[model samples]
Target chain A: MDINWQFIISTLPLYQKAAWITIKLGFWGTLLSLVIGLVCSIILYFRIKVLKELVEIYVELSRNTPLLIQLFFLYFGLTKLGITMSETTCAIIGLAFLGGSYMSEAFRSGIEAVSKTQIESGLSIGLSQMQLIRYVILPQAFAVTMPSLAANCIFLFKETSIVGAIAIAELMHVTQDVIGMYYQTFESLFMLVAAYLIIILPLSFLLTWLERKVRYAEFGN
Target chain B: MQNLGINVLFEGTTLQRLFEGLMMTAGIAFISIIIGSFLGIGMGLLRTSKSRIVQFICRLYLEVFRIIPILVWLFIVYFGVTNALDIHLDGEVVAVIVFSLWGAAEMGDIVRGALESLPKHQVESGKAIGLSFWGLYRYVLIPQAVRRMLPGAINLSTRMVKTTSLVVMIGVIDVVKVGQQIIERSIIKVPTASFWVYGLIFILYFIICYPLSKLSKKLEAKWEN
Candidate 1:
């Protein structure tokens, strides 16, 4: 496999810019999804009437569809309805729309895992509903949900690759651009794989460490 | 925008093309699932084997697939390998190969989870009955593990189906690509064609995946009870 190291070196700046965009998308996408997920889970836990069912339908619709189609629909389809967004905006929205449901599912499972007896005890101690959820339920659910939440975070980051489809200059986009320009397919792919590994491996370790910290604090094991 | 009726969806054999695209997507997903299941079951069995080397290899395979996005893998097989090695491979074939490998890795993990979740007594009873290792897996372990594996397997199948859309990136004319084509052809005449086209594709995917996901959930709930 003949790899052009010089070509790859020349393209480092392009990749750095693309990687920054990817990182930005991942950051914003994960944050939005987390907020959306937490809110939806809270709504479900409280059993809110119309909103609860709306959240359920939203979750199913988003989760059942692929992110690529979602991006297309958002970036291409929605423009027909006179709602326009920049590619990055559309990508972020697409990521959150998909990731929110998965994150909500993770959080819902975590909430369900909080034993009924704990909620009852918190209520008996005169904690209001909001306080009960805030102090008693969410902390435990957050701890139990940490692992899946971390997984979802990584999933969202990896998913940023799809944003390249909508013309966003992310890592995959840059890699493809390099290949197209230089015909350095091997070098371009090598850089692509390396960039993802460099970002993902460290993130994976950091998240694993964070998960362990959460578990230890919660369960003392 | 006023002419954005359902007519655009049916214009010039658009639905037929979309149907063909959907079939392509489904075909890739179906073939991969079948092959991946077989390979996965073997890898999963090996993963749970007593040998440390076997376990480590399985873990490595799973992690590699897990970390990188499927799009990268798709590009590697479809473009990188073909271009770098100066070989020819159909876009669809590369998609199948990559998805099969991915599906195997994912399914292997699922199978491993299902097998490991089986209680110790299941293995012991087979041994107590003087069964050989293969006989034990055949009669006792597999029968029980299959039950536990079904829901997860179904879930994985749905995921494979969804991920198949990524094949469009490799220039495979799947449903998403078909929608794009329809939109590109009529963008000027039907200003809102993309809305209808991509919307239909979205619903098409939803139609295929929703029931499977529901079925997975149903089986999981039923089995849990």
Candidate 2:
């Protein structure tokens, strides 16, 4: 079959709009996940009593299930209970729910890697607890966390594709729409792949660069 | 309006249909894992080859999978390639092909990491014993790498299982799709059927994945020493 350039060109506007929606979902999802991750990691790191166990359970539940089922439950399941949310809200919440667990694990590992000696040294140098966290602990932990954080960011962005199942017109949803309408399956699929590559490939490279730039001085070559 | 909360699950043929769907999901994951493991081992071995060109090709294969979502790959194969080639392929077959390719790429990296992590001394010792290259790999290298590959392999299997849920999108009547069908049929009699149906699916996935993840963790802890 011949490639249909005209069909692709005609659908370019729809693709652009869908791409923008995907970007918005990814952006909000990433931001919310980062916040939830940071908060949960801090709670677990300090071993907050009941909350620690609760966060652990939440992380396990979120991570063990697929994002697709989670979206279904959030979007379809909750509506029956009168807990209604927009499709966008459901998508963002589902992404964050999955991403938060992975991110917290990354953060937790980063925090654990900052040896006790560094914190002690900061304390001995007459630094207050807050000062020690800001000046010493935060820098080392952030450096170690950058690589995994970047990876989680990519994972979450790709996961936004699943949101299409809930009727959100993200990239995959629109591709399906076009395919079903005009039977231009090849062209539509080509555009779908191109859209993902355009978005993810650059982010991946930039993240790798950022990870390298943030490497702690002591983590030598 | 009739209120059927958890009872929606027990409606006619609902449980049985879900059971069949669950089997399909498991079957797909199991077949892909087996095929993917064999192919991944080969790819992993090549990744460690001395030739730069072979390494570059393997890296390219790995990155292509990593860079694109599995959902897009599904569409490209099931909808795009089949139409372009004028071939009729079953949705489950398409899902298996796509997932096996993905699983192989992930498993290849795990195998490569396990093989490379073996100390350089292991190889030198094998060489000193008059063992040929293949002999060293067979007798010394692969045996040790198998242990190191176990936890990672189990983890990847769990990941593959969870990811197989996406197969429903390509029209494979997996568990999620079955649940959606049940909800659509029962919506009038049980307006809350979706909640019960989807909630059960969530639990079903958890039941399948939770133990695999726990076992992976257990093995990692046991083998760490």
Candidate 3:
């Protein structure tokens, strides 16, 4: 079958819009997950009484199950309970919750990597617990966890594609729409793959460089 | 509980259908993992090649597959390539091919990391002992790397199992699809059938994956020790 280069070319705006939606989902999802992860990690680190167990259960369930199922559970399952939300809202919430589970683990390890002496020294210097965490532990923990966090972000970005399954019209969904419209599956799918590569390849390189910078800073380089 | 809904999963034929779907999921994951291991091992070995161009090409393959979502890859393979080639492949076959592509990329990275993390002296010692390349890898490098590769490979297998859920999007009547069908059919009888159906799926997956993940963690801890 001959490829329709022109059709693919004309659909650039559609692809761009879908790519933007994907980026928006990924950006907001990462931010939300980061917040949730940080809080969960801190609670677990301190071994907060009942909350720690609850967080562990959440993390395990999220990590163990497929993201598709989680998305479906929220989208279809919740609707059955008479709680309704837009597909985009559900997608963002599901992605964040999924990302949060993995991110919390990364954060926990990062926090653990901070030496005990550092915390004790901060306390000896009359830093309040909150101030000690803010001034001392968090910066170092952030550096240590930066690489894992970046990796998680990339994973979350790819995962945003699943939103397409629930009809959210993200990049993958839009590609499906274009394919349905033009019946030019090869060109449309090729373009979709290229769009993702264009975004991910450079972002990965940048993240690697940023990780190195963080490592250097941590080592006093 | 009655107000919630009847558990369609326990109804006649429904459980069997779900089990068949579960089997399909497992079968696809197993085959894909096997195929991916071979491809991944080859790519991983090539990644450490002395030639820059070969390494670059392998890295490109790894990165492209790694970066693109499996769902997209599934569409490309199932919808795009099949239509372009005018070939009719079964959904299960397509699922295997797409998942193997993903598994290979992941496994390649794992293998490359395992090999690279070994001390240089190990290779040097093998060479010093006059072992050929095959002999060196068989007798020296592989045995050490296998231990390192086990946890990652098993972890990838579990991931592949989880990811096979996406095949439903490609029209595979896997567990998720079967659950969707059940919900669609039972919606009139039980408005909340989705919760029961999907909740069962979630538990079924948890039963399979939770143990594998636990095993992976155990192996990782053992390796660290």
Question: What would the TM-scores of all predictions be?
Answer: 0.98, 0.97, 0.96
Angstrom error at residue B64, model 2:
0.4
Backbone clashes counted, model 1 = 0
Which 10 consecutive residues of model 3 chain A have the lowest summed lDDT?
Answer: A212-221
DockQ of 3: 0.80
lDDT of 2 by residue, A1-221 (tens): 78999999999999999988988998899899989998898888779999999999998898889999999999998998899999999899999999999989888888888889898989999998779867887688889999899999999989999999999999999998988999888889889988998889888998999999888544632
Backbone collision count in every prediction? 0, 0, 0
Worst 10 residues of 1 chain A by lDDT: A212-221
In angstroms, how far off is A85's CA in candidate 2?
Answer: 1.0
What are the DockQ scores of the candidates, in order? Answer: 0.86, 0.85, 0.80
Q: Model 2 TM-score?
A: 0.97
Q: What's the residue-level lDDT of A152 in candidate 1?
A: 99
Q: What are the per-residue Cα lDDT tens digits for candidate 1 across B1-225?
A: 356456898778999999999999999999999999999999889999999988998999999999999999999988877876789999899988998999899999989999999999989888998999999999888888999999999999999999998999888988888888888888888888988888899999999999999999999999995
- Indicate the TM-score of model 1: 0.98
What is the C-alpha local distance difference test score of candidate 3? 0.89
Candidate 3 regions exceeding 4 Å error are: B1-4
Q: Which stretches of candidate 1 lie over 4 Å from their true place?
A: A216-221, B1-3
Give the CA lDDT, 0 to 100, for residue A157 in model 1. 98
